[model samples]
Target: MVTPVRVVIALCLLAPFVAMLWVGSYAKVDPVFIGIPFFYWYQMLWVPLSAALTVTAYKLWQRDRRGRVAAAPASSGASPKGGASE
Candidate 1:
């Protein structure tokens, strides 16, 4: 059941958590952005980035759910190999 779309969705949702949790990567004062420190700016940047990623994941989830829902009836309606009884 591990599909490519599910993998992409997991990555999208995991990115922000990984980016924020890895403090050493952005724990700096140099490369200031319009007076804001790199640390602050980097963290703030993820706000929108996280939102976008979450939206993307949600849309993908909905699409995947729809596909599964559509396929469910077709799968369940089938008769056994011995055929159905009248």
Candidate 2:
């Protein structure tokens, strides 16, 4: 089942990859910021953006994992009583 939450998490993880891979989109020297060229600043910006996206994805994955574990049946922890049966 493709839940909306899974879709959102996928997008969160995909954002950084897509942004970094599309180099030509931001490969420009104009529109300098704080003496930094667009190309440099654009790549630098993704550092924090990637961090945020990774954190979001991590949280979503943890939540999904917890839900699955909670819904699953509990396993018996008891060991076999007989050591050597004749």
Candidate 3:
């Protein structure tokens, strides 16, 4: 069930977690940004970055799902509304 698209989607979803989990890498007061320390700015930076990555992952998953749905054979007996009709 694994595909390149899924792998990319996983990476997109995991990048922020990996970045934020490695706290030692950003635990520093140097490299201030307009008075904000690297530690604070770096964590804050991931807010938008995480959102972007999450969106990317979601889009990729959606594309992958669409591909699978298109490739699969349609069910002939299924009704559009799942309602019994005369």
Measured by lDDT, the strongest candidate is 1
Task: Give the per-residue lDDT of model 3 (tens digit) for 1-86.
Answer: 88899899989988998999999999999999999999999999999999999999999888887776566556544333444334
TM-score of each: 0.83, 0.77, 0.84
Sequence-dependent TM-score of model 3 = 0.84
Error of 2 at 58 (Å): 0.5
For candidate 2, give the lDDT.
0.83
Model 2 pairs whose backbones collide: none
Model 2 Cα lDDT, one tens digit per residue, 2-42: 87789999999999899999989998999999999999999
Clash totals for all models, in order?
A: 0, 0, 0
Ranking of models by lDDT: 1, 3, 2
Better of 1 and 2 by TM-score: 1
Per-residue lDDT tens digits for candidate 1, residues 1-86, read 99999999999999999999999999999899999999999999999999999999999999998777666554465443324434
Query: Between the candidate structures 1 and 2, which one is better when assessed by lDDT?
Result: 1
| Superposed model 1: Cα runs more than 4 Å off | 75-86
Q: lDDT values of the candidates?
A: 0.90, 0.83, 0.84
Ranking by TM-score: 3, 1, 2
